[model samples]
Target: MAALAAPTWRMGTTSLFPRLFSSTQQTRFALPFFPGVTLTIPIGIQLGLPSIPSILEGIWEGILKAVPKKKTSHMKKRHRQMAGKALKDVTSLCKCPACGETKRMHHLCPHCVSSEQLLHSLQRRKAHPADIFSLAPTPNSILSASGSSSLLVHSTTESTFPLIQTIPNAHKLGCHHVCTAKGGLGNVAASVGFGGEIKIWNKSQNKNEWALDWEIPPSGDVWAVALSENEEYLACTTSDGRIQVWDLNAKQVIQTYETGARGGGSFAMSVDLSRDGKFTASGHESGAVYVFNNDAGRMVYSLSGLAKPVRAVAFSPGCKRLAAAGNAGIIALYDMQHGEHVGNLTTPNARPAWITSLDWSDTGDYILSGSLDGKVKVWDVTRGACVATHSETEGALWSVRWLPKNERALGPGMGKGEMFCAAGASRSLTFYREATGI
Candidate 1:
């Protein structure tokens, strides 16, 4: 064909390929050799009797997608879904019958267990017919003072705390304060009465009864009193704001401390003698706390801070610091060495109530306080924090004292070796023991 050039071949474009196909799935092509001649072939025959390559590829892809993935364990699937949860709901709870408190089912009630501290009522007895004002614990007995004229002694060595004896008509006008000295091998107790008289008592060698040994006439009006460890000296606070130290053996005043001319001689409400007999401290109604040196026979330091009628003052067992409190509702601590106010212990967000009594633990680590609001608090001196509190009555608590550690009672289930007793307008003496042994 015109010396027909070698057969020409060309690739089909998408637009040209569509024209090559017919409605019947057949393809038509014009031959160059014959001017009007056309060639027709079945699409299946022209395309090798099979589906289009692109369609086959799509079908293969769909089949691959329909097949299942590699099998996975139920645990692995669950882990992927729930990965970040910790707490589980408690399905059961109930009310405790003993304490009327809500508690977890199958578990003991926390309130009842903690209320063991109040089990003190286990040995409760009417210590005094009237309100008990003070409690002083000896090695084996507790001496209680009340509005009555007699002093009641209870035997703590017995489980029932039976009344062992009573000092009849101990004070004609009724005693307001009673204290015992760590007074070497003998028992020496001192009592101050509203009649302005101070009496010294001695335990009888044959009867185990307290007998009046001697009496010291009031120089002025004796309001509060304390005895030295050896019972060799006595410290008393006067109505005119003077602290007088008396020689017990000599039966005379040996030293006197004055609080200056403030408020026309502030009323000395409380007085305490150091265990070493080297210092005497006093709290005054004019909000002044004074420390006096016995050897020098003069006032050494005047501590100021609680300006609201200081009522109670106490010295640490070491005689290194002083704690003073009163209607101010806070306890002020002072360094005896410098007479500087060191710190304060205050109840958080509580209305100020008069603190009536303060006592330090034998170890000097804790300070026990009783307040007019009938609350007793145990303060940790080193941490400056209240470690325990008890409010069994709404009436004022006048006195609180820590009992000497009892080695025999420190057995299993007996709580801490430490014990304390509180008394006041509630007309009862409540004993408390540490819930856990230290």
Candidate 2:
């Protein structure tokens, strides 16, 4: 047999127990090891695994660098690099709605409108709402009352929407309520204010701009007003709890209904006449909702059950139900026929948020409400459940209205194409359309 060479170690300690060449020879071999050191690992096999010597060396270097550094400049440079990377990650998520362009989501999109300077300008000029008591919308124009003092005619021509013409000082004193009949004719506009007076405005457009033609003096500051579908009879609710119906053609008070048998003078907040002009609904601050039969000319039902001041009351398009909501954060629905309380709708974690505005879809399929909590919700009338909720701000929402349906395309019940508008303490109006097809 050929002789075999033995392996040799130069410096490091070898295992204490070494294997012998023959079974008869001793197997134990005590190699020199430093004091306090205790390790005996075998070395000889060759397995095909990648060596990671460089990885271990890099990890050791990182550990040494991570310790407290003495220099302030180097630490600041490292932090700035980390912050730059974070900003880059955040800019990736913002996008624009109108053009589908990527932009900071929290910041306004530049392509849509100039928000930078306009926001600051609005802040410098504080809230100066002229106490608009009545606002009636038409296809081409809008009639508004200014605190029982003036009549302002606004043009709905600037956008696809309306713009205010702001006729200054149309009334001798501030007016409480002003409204136009169903169709925009010349002589049907009405205004009432603080003093026991009512004035009618007629637009006689000759060669120049149309101007007010005549004025009528009625009994009180009209707190709320409504008009018949035929535009013949005008109904105005006074602060003293009397709803006076006027003959627009005759220019005289036809009849008056006394509210507040549930203890009057709780200021009628809202009033509306049915589409058929047979029933009139009124909501009072005393939490009382009264429905009267204008055809029979008497009080029909005094709907009860709401405990808080009723701020908003709306009759559905079909005049089948009335929804009233207020400081209680609960919305109560009443059957118009029997004046019986039907059901209530409320948010789950309902804030004691005052209900400010209400509007029903033309089909009576949905009822939209806006509240002090700045939430606009769409309620499914048939199911009596909230279908959609949009909370855009924490400011009070003052007005919510559904745009009249398009008669050319499909009526209210047939298609899903619909639009609504909301405006409030934020000083900006928002328009929303159905996001999906019906």
Instruction: Give the top-scoring candidate (lDDT).
Output: 1
- Tell me the TM-score of model 1: 0.71
Model 2 residue 268 CA deviation in Å: 2.2
| True-structure lDDT of candidate 2 | 0.63
Q: How does model 2 score by TM-score? A: 0.62
Per-residue accuracy of model 1 over 1-438 as CA lDDT, tens digit each: 422322221123223455544335545577797665445544542334456786899999999999999998999988887877646776556666555667654333457553443344444546677778877778777888888999988776644456789889998777889988642334888898888999999888788888999998866688998888887889998888888889988988898777766335888999999988999999988888889999998888988888898889999988888999999999999999899999999977558789999999888899999999998889999999887777778989999988776657532233336677889998777766542213
What range of 10 consecutive residues in model 2 has the weakest lDDT sum? Answer: 1-10
Once fitted onto the true fold, the runs of candidate 2 whose alpha carbons sit more than 4 angstroms away are: 1-134, 144-164, 172-176, 181-188, 194-196, 202-213, 260-266, 390-394, 406-416, 426-430, 434-438
Local accuracy by lDDT, each model: 0.79, 0.63
* TM-score on alpha carbons, each prediction: 0.71, 0.62
| Residue-wise C-alpha lDDT for candidate 2, range 371-395, written one tens digit per residue | 8878888888788887776677677
lDDT comparing candidate 1 with the true structure: 0.79
RMSD of each: 18.4, 15.5
